[model samples]
Target: MVNAPAEQKKLPSWWSGGSVVYQIYPASFKDDDGDGYGDLRGIINKLGHIKSLGVDAIWICPHYKSPRVDEGYDISDTDIHEPFGTREDCQELIDAVHAHGMKIMFDLVVNHCSDQHAWFKESRSSKTNPKRDWFYWKPPRMIDGVRHPPNNWRSCFGGSVWEWDEHTQEYYLHYFCSEQPDLNWENPETRQAIYNDAIRYWLDRGVDGFRIDTVNMYSKYLDFPDAKVVAPETPWQPAGDFFSNGPRLQEFLREMRKEAFSKYDCFTIGELPNTPSLEKILSYISTDAEALDCTILFDLADLDHRGGQYPLMGRNWALSQFKALTAFAQQLAEPEHKAHALTYLENHDQARSVTRYASDAPEHRLTSSKLLATYLLTLSGSVIIYEGQEIGMINAPKDWDIDTEYLDVNTINTWREIKHDAKVQNDPSLLERGRAGIQLTARDHARTPMQWDGSKNAGFSSNPDAKPWYRVMESYAEGLNVGAQEDDPNSTLNFYRQLVSLRKAHKDLFILGRFQLLDPGNDQTMLFTKTALDGSQVAFVALNFSAEKQPFELPIELTARQSQLLISTLGKSSESRELDAYEARVYLA
Candidate 1:
C-alpha cells in the first residue's frame, strides 16, 4: 500500500447521510480526443454539467485496461486503459472532481480478471507454475474414456463455466466469460496482492472509494460440486446459489475493511446481485458488521423480471406493487438498523427508468418522468442518478433493430439465444417476439451516448465527420438533447435540479427522517410521509401513477391544520384533493 499523506483526507461525518451519486458510463459519456470513444479528458470537460445536477459524488464505470470484452468489466490490468488515457489523466479527473466539491467512486471488479492478465497468463503457463493456485483449476472428469467438465456449473454469459486447456490438460473455472477467469480469493497471497496492489493503488491516488463489483461472489465452496440443473434444455443454467454470496463472503469483506478501507476515510458500496435474504443483506451493511457502507440490491430492479431472470422480458409492474416494495425497502433501512441505504431507480445494467416505469406516450412522458423524479429524490436514502436520466432520455428508438443496430454484448448474446430457441421450436413468429423483448430490456438502451446537443453525434464528439462508437438515440434532435432543455424552466432537466435542491435543503426531513407508507390500499396512487424522529418536521409526497385523474383525501387531522405546498409536477397550488394524471406533490405538513 502506498503510504501517501494525501490519502488521509478528512471527510465529514454527514457524508453518507444525505449524499447523491450520479453514475457515468465513461465510454458513452463524451469523446474528447475524437477517437469515437469517451476518454478521461471527456469527463473532465463535463464536470460543470455534472456539478449542475447537485450530486455529491460520481460513480464512473470501469475504464481500466481491458480488451473491451463485457464493456471493460473484463480487466487485463487495474491501471487506466490506453484508450481512456494514461494514469495521469485518471489522477487529474479525481482532482477535478474534488475541486467541484464532489467525490469520485471507481468501479472495482475483483471477482475475476481477464485471462490475458499477467497473473492469469502465468497460471495458465504450466500445471506446476507457482501461480497455478492463483486461479481455480481442476482435473477433468472422465466417463467411459470420454473427458467431460468436472461439474455442471455454467458461465453467466453462456455455456459451461469450465474451459479445458489442451496444453495444460486441466480446466479453469470462469463464472462470467471464458476470457475472464475467477480469481482464487481463498489464497492468502492472491487476497493480499489484490488489496495492496489494486485497492490501495487507487486510494493512494485520491479516489474517494469503490463500487465493489460482484462483491458477494468472492468466495466459493471448497469442493467443486455440481450445480442443480434449473433448465435442462438450455446450455446455461442458474448456478448463483452455489457461488453468489458464497460461504466466506462476509469474512473476506471484514478482512478487506480492516486491511485496506480502514486506512482512509472513504466510502464503499457493493453491487451485490442475487443476495439471499433481507437479513443477509442487512448484515453486509450493518454498522455492527463494519464490512461495507452500503450495497445495491437487485430486489427492486427485478420487480417485473420474468421468473427472476434479468435478461428475459418481464411484465409491467403495478403501482401498488411498487409501493409495497419501497415500503419493505424502507423498513429494512430503518434507523434502528444503523445501516446506510443506496437507493436508485436506474444504473448501467438496467434500461432507463423513464421507459421502464413511465408511459413513453408523448402526452404523458414528461409528467411521468417528473413523477418518478419526485419519488427518487424524496425517498429516505442516498440517491443515484444515471447519465442522461436528468434530461428525460428514453430507451433506444423502437425501430432500431436489435440484431443489426445494438452493440451491447449482453443484448447481442441474449438476442442470439432467443433466435436460436425460436428456430429449434420451428416458430418464425417467435423471432419477432424475441426482437421486441430485446428492444424493451436491452442494456444498450442505457448505453447510448449522452445527448449534449442537437448536433450530429449529439455533440458527444467535436469532429463533425466522426461517428460514435455506439448508435446515438434517434430522438436527440427532436428535443431530448441537453442544449434544448437547459433554458426551459419546465424541462425535465430543470425539474431534476429543483428536486435535488429540495432534498439538499431539507436533509433532516427527507434523508434522516423515518419513512412511513400511507394509503397502501390505493392501487392507482402511491403516498408516503417522511417525519423527523422528534416529530418537529413532516412531509407528505403523493403520486398519481395512473393515466386518469384521481381523487385523494388528506387525513382529517392533517387537513385540519394548515399545510404548505413545497413542490409539485403540475406546477399549481396544492389546495385541491384531486390529482391530475401522473401528478406528484410534496407538502410540508
Candidate 2:
C-alpha cells in the first residue's frame, strides 16, 4: 500500500454533496505540440477555463499506454499514461488540478485490454502458457470436421463474441470488440494484479479517484451460459445479465477495497449498463457495501429514443424526453442506500445533447441546453458534464463524415456492420462514409477540437494543415473560439458560467437536500423541488416537452409574500409565471 503523506489531514466531501465534475476527452480537448491529438500539457493549459466553470473535479478520459483500439479504454499498462505524454505529465496534471483546488479522476478500463497487450498476447500464444487461463478462452467444438464457437453470444459492436484463435486452436469471447479481449475475473491472480497495480499506480500519482468502465461485467457466471439471443444472425448483444454481477463480484470488490481504495478517501463510479434493479446498484455503492462509491446507470441514456420517447439516432430530442429522464433521476435519488448516480446529458460515447434535442436552430438549441442544465443540476447525485456541453455544442452536421478513421476499433467495426445490413440500404452512402453520419454521432460531435478561437485550427493546434484525427465543426472558424466567447457576454460559455455559479452557491439546497417531485403525473413536463434539512426550500426545475407554455401550480400551500427568481432561462420568473418553450427556472419559495 502507498503511504499517505503526513501533511494530509482531511478529505473532500465529493460523495455527500453536489460536486461539479468536468469530463475531458483528451484526444480532442487540445493539442499542445501539434501532434494531431490532445496531450497532458494541453489540459494543464486549460485549467483556468475549468476553474472558471466553478467545478470541483475533472475526470480525465484514459491516457494510459495502449494500442488505442478503443481510444485509451483498451489499456495495456496500468502504471503509465502513454503516447499522450509521460507518467510525469499525468502527475503534473494531477498537481495542476490540485493547485486549482480541484480533484482529478482518471478512467480505469480493467474489464478488457487490447489484443496487443502483453498479457493477452501471452495468453493467446499457447494453451499451456502460465497466463493461458488469464482470459476467457474456450476449446472450439468439432462440428462436421470444422471448429465451431462454444456459444452464440454477440458482441457490443454486433456479431459473434467468439474469435477463433488459430494459434491456440480455441475461441475467446470479447464482449466489446474482437481486438478488446475480455479479462477473466474468475481468476484470482488476474483480479489481484489489476487491482494492486492500477490503484497503486494512480494513488501513488496522487489522483483523487477513478471512473470504472463496465465495472459490473468484471465477474461472470462460471457456466458462461449463452445470453438469450435478441438478434441471432445480425450480432446485437443484450445486457449480458447472465454474465454480469456474478457471485464473485462482491468478493473481488472487498479485496480491491481492502488493498487499495480503502487506504485513501477515493471515489470510484462504475459504468453498469441496463442495471435497472435498485438492489444491484445498492450493493455496489452503498457506504457500507463491498464495492465502488457510485455508478453511471444506463437508464437515462437508454431512455433517449427518437419515436418521441428516447432517440439514439441523430434525430431531434423532445422536451418531454428530457423531462422524463430527470424524473427517473429524481426517483433513483430517493433510495435510502442509493448508490450515487452520475447524471449526464452527453458523454464521449453518446451523441451531443444540443443536436439530439434541438433541430438545426441555434435558439432552440440554447434553450434546450439550459433546460437540461436545470434538470441535471437539480438531481441529488454527482453531475458529469461532457467536454463541449458547457457552450451547447451540437452534433456534427449531416454533411460531415470521416469518423471511422478516428474511431476506436469496435466503433468502426459496428459502423461497418450497420452499413452492410440490408435493412438500412436506403442510405448506402452512410456506410461508405463510415456511419460517420450517425453510429459515431454523439462522440465525434463532442470530440470536435475545443473551440479556442476563430484561428487557423480553432486555436486547438498550431498547424492548420495538420489533420486533427477528427473533423472540427466549421463554427470555430466563424467566431465560436474561446477568445470570442470570453468577450461576448451572450455566448453559451457565459450562460454556463452563470449556471455553474448558481449550482455552487446553492449547494445546501441542491447537494444535501431531498428531491421531491412536483408534477409527478405529468409526462409532458418535469418539475421538482429541493427542500434542505434546514428548511430552506428551493423549487428547482425545467420545462422541455412541448413548445407551448405549460402552467403549473405549487404542490405545497405556500404563503410567502413573494417568490424570488434566482435564475431563469426565460426572462424573469416573476414576470412570466408560465414557462416558455424549453424554459427552466430556479426559485426561492
Candidate 3:
C-alpha cells in the first residue's frame, strides 16, 4: 500500500460541499445514434438541458466494456463499451462537460469484474495459474457422495454464491451474478493493480471523481462461513455481516485513498448497503480519517421495506416514518462530525420518488412534487437528483404485464422469484401482491427512457420507428414529457428549477449552516431550520406531507424576526400559517 501523509491529502472544496449532482443512467438517457441505445454522443447532445437544471455535476452510470449480463455492472474490460461509445467519444464528452462549466463523475465498479474479463479467465484457467489467487476459489464440499457449494452464502441475484467450474473442478464465489466474480481485495497484487491500472488511468483522463458502486463490500471475512438465518422463510439469509462491511474495509479504503485519491482534487462517494446503523456509516466517510468524502446509506429508503425473502419490497411509507428518517439524517450534519451525508430521494436503482413517496393523483402530484423538492434542496448535506425526477415522473402503470412489457434485468429476475414462490404456495393472492409490489418497488420504473417530447420514442431517439431498449411510459406523450412542462410557470419542472436556484443563492445557509430539527414530534408536518454559525442568517423549511391542508404556527422565537418568503408551492404568503394540501415553503430571516 502507498503510504501517503494525511497532510498531503486534498480536502473537499466549498463547491464540492454545496454542489448538487444529477445522476444519468446512460442506457436510458438518450439514443443519439438511433440504435435503440443511449451513447456518449447522446449525452453530449443533451448537456444544455442539464445545464438548465442548474446541477453542478453529473454522475454517469457505468459505460465500461461489458457483456451486459447485469446491464453495465458486469465490466469485461477497462475500456469504453462499443455500444455506448469509443474511447475518443468518451474523451470528447469529458472535454465538452468541462467546457460547459460542469464536472462529470464516472461510476466506478471495483468490487467485481465480469467473469469474461481477462484476469478472471487467467485465474480460472488452472489451479496452478499465477493469477489463481486473484479470486475466491475453493473445492466444493463432498457430502454423502454429492458435490455441494462450499458454504450457504447466496448470491444477491439468487441461488448459491459459489458456482462450480467444471474446467478446474473448483467453486468460484460470486456475490452478484455468476457472470460477475468478486475480486479478492486481500491479495495485494490484485488491489494494487485495480488502483494503479484502472483507477489512476481514469483520473489521468481529466475525469472529476467517481461514485463508487458497492464500495463497502470490498473486504470480506477471512473464513468463509455460513451466514446466520435471519429470515427463516427464505432458503438463505443475506450475508451482509460477513461481506458488506468487513473487518478490513476501513484499512482497504484508507489504502485506496492514500494510493490514488489523496493525490488529486476529487471527491469520493461510496454506496454503503445493509448498513442500518449510522455509526457504521460514519466510520467509512468521517472526514477525520483518510476515507471517502461522503457515503449513501439506505436506512431512510428502507423504512417501508417488508418481506425479508426478497431484497426489493415496498409499501406506502408513513408520514411519521418519513419525518423520523429525515430528522435522523439531519442530525448527521452536526458541526462536530467531519463526515457529510449524501441526501437523495431517487436514483437509477430506485423507483420514481413522486410515485413512491408522494401522491399519484393528477391534482396532487404537482404539489407533492414541489413539497419534496423543497425539503430535499434545503437540507444541510449535498443532494443528488435522478433524471426525470424534476418533471414529476411516476412509476409505470400497475397493470403492466412484466412478461410482455419492457423490464430491466433486476425487475425480471425478482418477478420470476416471486412468481415461483407464489405458485408453489398455491395462493393466488400472493401473486397479486407480488405484482403490486413490483409496481411500487421495481427499479425499472426509473430506467424508462427520458420523456423529452411527444414525438416518436418520446423524443429520446431520432428514428421514428426505433424501439427503445426499455418501453417509454404511456403518459409521456399525453402530458408528462419535458416539452409539455418546460415553459409552464407553475409546472413541477419549474418548481425544481426554482428550488435549485434558491439553494444556490443561499449556499451559506443551506450548505454550510447548522441543521436543527424543530417540532420533531409532529407527524403530518416537518419543520427544520438552518442557521449560520454566527446566527446572522437563518432559513426555515416547512413541509406538509398530508393530502389535507394543515394549520401550522411559526415558533414564537421566529415570530419576532422578519420573514421573507423564498419559495412556496401554494404561490402565496399566508399570515395565518395555514398550509395548503401538500404545501412546502421556505422562509429566510
Model 3: number of clashes?
A: 0
Q: Estimate each model's TM-score.
A: 0.95, 0.90, 0.95
Point out where model 1 deviates above 4 Å.
1-14, 306-310, 428-430
Pick by lDDT: which candidate is best?
A: 1
Superpose all Cα atoms of candidate 1 onto the true structure and report the RMSD in Å to 1 decimal.
2.2
Clashing pairs in 3: none
State each model's C-alpha RMSD to the native.
2.2, 3.6, 2.7
lDDT (0 to 1) per candidate: 0.83, 0.70, 0.83
Name model 3 segments beyond 4 Å from true: 1-8, 11-15
User: What order do you get sorting by lDDT, best first?
Assistant: 1, 3, 2
* Candidate 2 displacement at residue 322 in angstroms: 4.9
Superposed model 2: Cα runs more than 4 Å off = 1-14, 79-82, 232-239, 305-325, 358-360, 402-411, 423-442, 478-480, 521-523, 557-561, 571-574
Answer with 1 or 2, whichever has the higher lDDT.
1
